[model samples]
Target: MFDQSRGFRDDAVETCPVEYVVRKDGKPFAFLNATPALATRTVTGFALATPEADWTFERI
Candidate 1:
């Protein structure tokens, strides 16, 4: 699901634990944590977007 055209980049750390880090065009984007949290924004640009649905939790 990693699309090069979208200019998405991902990384992870070992010593300090974190799920993963995501970036776009070499800038800070998102941090996918180990636990789920409320979705504060609506998904638009990604495929299978559920704009109509009241998405409450994030799990990736």
Candidate 2:
């Protein structure tokens, strides 16, 4: 059960190393926040968004 509302932009592109970057929902941080360390301001990690897509930890 995958929720499509989780910012999975452009679901048509079936390829990866696709970055899963999520910035603060509002204006506070000047950068696009990513994941894994959500406790801090910026979260950074990897996401194999679909069977075809994945964001490697290196690019982040």
Q: Quote the positional error of residue 15 for candidate 2 in Å.
A: 32
Candidate 2 lDDT tens digits, 1-60? 334787555633443233443333322333333333342222323122223333222224
The global C-alpha lDDT for each of the candidates, from Candidate 1 onward, is 0.36, 0.34
Which regions in candidate 2 have their CA more than 4 angstroms from the true location? 1-31, 34-36, 39-48, 57-60
Backbone N/Cα/C clashes per model = 0, 4
Give residue 53's error in model 2 in angstroms: 0.9
Question: Can you write out model 1's per-residue Cα lDDT over 1-60, one digit (the tens) per residue?
Answer: 345876553432222233444434344456655422212322222213534433232334
lDDT of 1 at 51: 42
Clashes of 2: 4
Q: Quote model 2's TM-score.
A: 0.18
